[model samples]
Target: MQSKIDPDMVDLNERHELLYTSSPIAALPIEILSLVFHEVQRTRRATGKPMIPHVEITLSHVCSHWRAVALSLPSMWCVFQHSYAPWYGPVRPTRERLAVYLERSGDHPFDLWIDFKTNEPAYQRLFFPLLEITLPHVHRFRVLHLLSNANHPLKEFVEQLASASAPLLETCAICPDYSHTSLTSLIANKADIFRSGVPSLKYLRMDETSMFGFLPPLDSVVHLRIETRRTVPSWIPNTAFDAILSLPNLETLSLSIELFELQAFPSRGSVPKEPIRANKLKHFRSAYVLINIYTLSHVVAPSLESITMNGVDLAGLDDRPSIPNHVAFPSLRIVAFIRAKGGSHGARHGPNLQKLMAGTQNVEELLFWGKTGIEENTEKTHCMLLGTDSAPSPWKKIKKATLNIPFSSPTEILLYHQFIAAKPNLEVLRVPPRCLELPTFLQGVPPHIDLRAIDESEPPLPLCWVPGPDWLDTEEDPFLFYCRVFE
Candidate 1:
């Protein structure tokens, strides 16, 4: 049987087919479309304004089919970070929007980031329901506690969260909290973490004080990061240090401590009676502490590959601590000591460079920083010269090194010229930043220096960031700004 079709209905069907096949948005995969939405939302947050000019949401209002697809796919509406601006309007509506987003995420594991910049405690209470709904699904959580007031609502949320059983929890990051007077106070207020069994937690980071108290016994955490403040805590307990060492699977440990507060717990028997050792541990970075060489010799696992000390004060060995000779690191490869101009008891490591290299024979990369006041005196500066009568360095295997020189005057340039000329095997040479402007520095240099062949190629010099506490304040790329000239 043949029936006559309406002309308007046939025309509408043809147009819908053309639109679906021709437009780029219709061609996009669901994942790619979700990423596009994420990028749009990210830009809105950075600019600190209310402007959702995307007209896609209005498309679902046209019919039930589009709304059903959008609602069924949880990823389409799971992100809500618009609560930063309080002046925009009431907080209840945003809270409701967040609850909707959480509900849409469903039972699938997901990464959750919550930044509580809003200073109002009353508005924070509104998020409790959202947290209750979303906590179970969080696999990775990053909470930035930027609230200025003493009474932080997020703190209460964390307390409640720690007590609740979260089977899917894996990673957590807690920034510098201004509310707690000390680490003990922070832990005492949040001791409920001890009761919480995060059997699946793998990575944990906290400021030094909270690290002592809140970290429960974890057998699976592979990476641990501890950041301490500039002012030393009154003291840290030995039991706390013991608890840290006891972690069975801790592989990479990064410790960021100020120069004045690098001492090990008790300065005696910090390691537990059980002889706790991390068989898998490899990398260690002490951001600003004058590293206790003895501690390096004893505490590190046998398979250590890289050790970096940045802006630490390495002074007279009289006060330097000792480690048991029984301990040994057989696989050490890269060792870096980055000292800047303002370091206390400056340039002491220069005198012991040979000893350091000899200890790590397999070293591939050795970095040293000598800029301004570090080498102002010729007697003190002579320590860097390889075969000088007073200073000798036998760091033969080093393939790459960096020297930071920050000077605008000619006298410093002439001094640095003399300083760099002394090392014959110096494959990598970093001219001071100020001197790079001069044509003579880069006159005939090739675009890229080839290290393997020593011909006309200049040594493959590269700029590196001197790791210190201040590095945290800037972008995550530690060496990007200093290496812009190379670009």
Candidate 2:
């Protein structure tokens, strides 16, 4: 039985074939294809998943027209992917693919992220060729969680990268090399190169390396993150701190110090003698489980506008010293304190906090957590929490706040009252679950606060009572304590 094709459907099929066969590439506008490619690249980067499959690349490799269109746009070829790990060893096409992408990328600095945890030995071989391919063109580079044991090759590779002048490389993040290689020689060799000046470079982060020594004077760096852990103290020289402070562009600094296992910057050595003040810094976050008085001295900067201390003590105090009124955070706008242990001992509170608040005449937000570090000594803690006896604070400009203390007392309520009194312009107040139990929590607050009602004229003051960790799970279930603020 012969199946007869309908003439109408047959003509439609013939027309489609004609369109597909004759200049299909031209039919797809370059602008439309460019948008498609951009979207694909963004998806790949965001998912942090598998590489763009070989099949996809092969599709573009299928015909001359496809290849021509794909290769014409260099931006389409730039990739910061880990899928090509299979070609870790110095293989033939790996180098070629890298070169093709680099040429296609054409002058736009590229970020290449390589993950070595998948296959160590394979990556060892792959790393060399990749380095050969990337050392010349590195705009910014990051290597995450590389585990290089005794047998792997990392030191040599790092040396090559350090020597390569990446003037445009503004950011680099290399995680702790869990591998057992000593970093002394590595840092010693690269110190001068790093100092010689990469003007465009602004942010640099490294792990397992004590940068207190051998670093050249840093006049260009503004943001620096260095980690040192469980190592011989001899590796880091105090001179590194001095060199870092000499930087002219420093605006924001984040320090995470590991005291138990890692070596501290040399105390007896020559220190960085830059003015004790940070001139342009607007934000600072410190998270050191244990910071000494010397370290605190190194951190105090006159230009600090905001400070966030997570598991850190700002001013290292002695055995129950009076809270000083001289500790400075001048332009402070927002201050957040997060608990590492619980309580505030050998830390800033009471008068010291008042002084900090007074220094920040323009402060708009203030956050405090009762428990962190040691359990607050009852007598001293009461004095600090009670705050000073005064009229509505002229210094309190707090418009937004978050209190996550596990327990609340009369002192905490007093602080809240002070905030409401001081910030006449306060538009939003966020309180933790326990803090809402305070008797006068929303005493004078108005009813019917609506975000929609908030505008240039007829501005609204809205208060948000946030739930504690006990109520908030990964799934955002609304388990909140009842409040009659609106009523």
Q: Candidate 2's residue-wise lDDT over 1-487, tens digit each? A: 9676454775664655445456555577867866776676565544434554532364365455556667777666655444334544334555676676677767665755444444445556765666566766654432112223334435555655444455665655444234343343332224533443465767555444424222332456676655443343333444444344435678765554432222223433343354345566665655543332333344456676666554223333443223234455555677655444334433544444454445456767655544435455432432343233543343446666554443355554655555454456666655554444445655634442211211223211111213222111111111111111111
Whole-model lDDT values for every prediction: 0.47, 0.47
- Return the top candidate by TM-score: 1
List the lowest-lDDT window of 10 residues for candidate 2: 471-480
Q: Which pairs of residues clash in candidate 1, taking residues 3 or more apart in a chain or in different chains?
A: none
Off by over 4 Å in 2: 1-26, 43-64, 83-100, 103-108, 117-126, 138-153, 176-197, 210-217, 227-239, 259-274, 289-302, 311-329, 341-355, 376-395, 407-425, 432-487
User: Per-residue lDDT tens digits of candidate 1, residues 252-356?
Assistant: 666554322233334643344454455677766665434444245336467777666542224433554443434456677666554432434444344244355
After superposition, candidate 1 runs with Cα above 4 Å error: 1-67, 77-91, 117-132, 136-153, 176-178, 181-196, 229-234, 258-276, 290-294, 311-327, 339-354, 369-382, 385-392, 407-487
